[model samples]
Target: MHSSAVFLIEFGAIILGLGLLGRIAGRLKFSPIPLYLLAGLAFGEGGLLPLGASEEFVAIGAEIGVILLLLMLGLEYTATDLVTNLRTQYPAGLVDAALNALPGAAMALLLGWGPVAAVVLAGVTWISSSGVIAKVLGDLGRLGNRETPVVLSILVLEDLAMAVYLPIVTALLAGVGLAAGSVTLAVALGVAGLVLFLAVRYGRLISRFVSSDDPEKLLLVVLGLTLLVAGLAQQLQVSAAVGAFLVGIALSGEVAEGAHNLLSPLRDLFAAVFFVFFGLHTDPASIPPVLLPALALAVVTAATKIATGYWAARRSGISVKGRWRAGGTLVARGEFSIVIAGLAVTAGIEPSLGPLATAYVLILVVLGPLTARYTEPLATRLSRLTRRHRPDTSAGDAPPALASEGPALTVDPDTAMSGSATHMTLPPSRGGS
Candidate 1:
């Protein structure tokens, strides 16, 4: 009885504090993620005031938070959309993985963390924070930009990749033998394929069965199904998050929208708790030793993400500025990074890995919004400065390819949002390079 009371009081205080922090973040037009982590640091082990009664509850909430995050991410697109993106934008996705995932893998191996840890860290660096990037796009009013589709395509590819990657990590972390691991991988892939097929073929029926005019019933049904499926997937070593994501993909139309609305608040609450939970496990003292490496990794990965985006946008014939904008927008790695690292932490892989990931995410998440806003302008300014210092060349000296570089085709946000952006093409220009 005494413990229950303490738990309630502590949990209530933490919730209230989170509310205040969230409001402050809203007013400042920044992500609350960093603030949440700082709060956790202050209230965690070896901090000013460590949490006792609510720590376990926070951990559970954190897991739910990840499930909900992936679920809603799945809800954003239909299975057909996924197939279309995979077919059309695969080159960009490949580039994205190569440029972004490699650095983290290299860093992990350099640190002598072995192959499993390397895979985990590679995922940590590979994915951009969909939540943060979405919010940033809306805030910056760049949702309609020509490059936004390119940005989102890369993100979608990453999310789809996670559906496979998480299961592999689970098998690795469990130290499963070759035959068992093969079975696990096969099951995961087969299940993913079956879900995608059913979703494409009969998504309407699935949504109709779950949907209700009553929002309360709708919410309960969808949430219940998601948890059930997630649990079963975990039992099969396929990853609960992936299962929740697949459930979401199977839901479409009005049902998906309704569930998303009903769960948004819960997602926000639990997601905040998730970030705090990650911070809690990480010793504040451990961060400094890893801070330099984290910063270096951040700098390198940021550049690679930018390059990936720029290359993708350019391939699609976007203007130079739009390419830069796309690149900058891809630089932030938030919840997903922590999610990947959290797996390694739970497996007790490397003590320093958690701190390194925490520091890396902290640096990037805060820097992400700033980059989304300024990278284009910064690049433009540098270009002008470089031009001013360079020797003047005659018109004929300019390369033909440079002269033909033209304005990119513009796409409405709705069109790109709908996955019809595969048809978008750039127009050739006879004007300036």
Candidate 2:
């Protein structure tokens, strides 16, 4: 009875605190994720006042949080959308992997952790936070922008890549040999392909089976199915988050939409708990030791993410402003980065990985929204400044005869940079001879 009472009080207090933090962030026009993580750190093992009874329950809730996060992400699009993105946006995905992932791998190696740790850290840096990015887009009213689809396509590709990447990491962390790892990889691929096929071919039927007009029944059924599948996947040596995501993909139509609405509140609650759970495991004191490396990693990866986004958006023919916006939007790494690092930390890979990842994510999550809002204007200002200070090289060149006749031959930054214009007008040359 005493334990139950303690659990209730602690859990209730957590919920209440999260609500207040969320309200504060809303008022401040910012994300509450960093604040949520800080709260967890404060209440965790090394912090001010750690909870006794609720820690176990919070752990379970955190697992559920990860599953729900992946599941809801799946519901955002159809199987067709996934296929289309994989086919068309694969180059961007590859670029993203190369630019963002290599830095983490290099860092891990430089720290003398083995190849397995390198692979794990690679994933930690590769993925962007879809939840945070989506929220920012909605908050900033950028959903209708020309570059938004480009951003979403890249995000979807990354999520799909996780379906494959997570299983490999799981196998590596488990210390499986080549034959066993191959089998595991094969099974994971088969499962993923089969789920995609079913989702594409019979999604409506599957949704009908799971659907109910009654909200209570609907929530129970959906949540139960997700947990069951996730558990079984784990038992099969596959990642549970992948299983939950597959289940989400296999549902469509009104059922998908209904389940999404019913489960959103639950997702938010558990997701917050997951972030806190990550913080709980990380010792705040450990962070300061690795703070310099983490800060360096954050800075390097932020630039690479921006480059990846800029290249992808430019390839898609978005305007200059849209390209910068796309780059900046992909800068934040939140839940997934923590999830990857948590797996490594749990596997006893490296003591310092957790703290470094925590600090890195905290820095980027805070910087992400600000960059998304300001990157374009900043880039524009810098470009103008560069032009203003550039030395003139056309002093001896003759001005074009059409320059005076063609409205001064002004160039639109977007048109010129996007390569959409057929003709370029040389800047009116300085008079010579």
> Which number leads on lDDT?
1
After the best TM-score superposition of candidate 1, give how far the Cα of residue 413 lies from its true spot, in angstroms. Answer: 14
lDDT of each: 0.89, 0.87
> Cα RMSD to native, each candidate?
6.3, 8.2
TM-score per prediction, in order, is 0.91, 0.91
Model 1 residue 2 lDDT score: 98
User: Candidate 2, residues 1-433: lDDT per residue as tens digits?
Assistant: 9999999999999999999999998899888899988988899878888878999999999999999988888777778788888888899999999999999999999989889989998998899998789889778867656677788888889999999999999999999999998988888999999999998999888999999999999999999999999999998899999999899888877888888989999999999999888888888988898899889999999999999999999999987888999999999999999989989888888888988888989999999998889998899999989987998687458567745565466554443343322222221100010
Give one digit per residue, the lDDT tens place, for model 1 in 120-236.
999999999988998898788775567887888888889899989999999999999989999999999999999999999999999989989999999889889999999999999
What is the overall TM-score of model 1 with all chains considered together? 0.91
| Model 2 spans > 4 angstroms off | 392-433
Model 2, TM vs. native: 0.91
For model 2, which pairs clash?
A: none
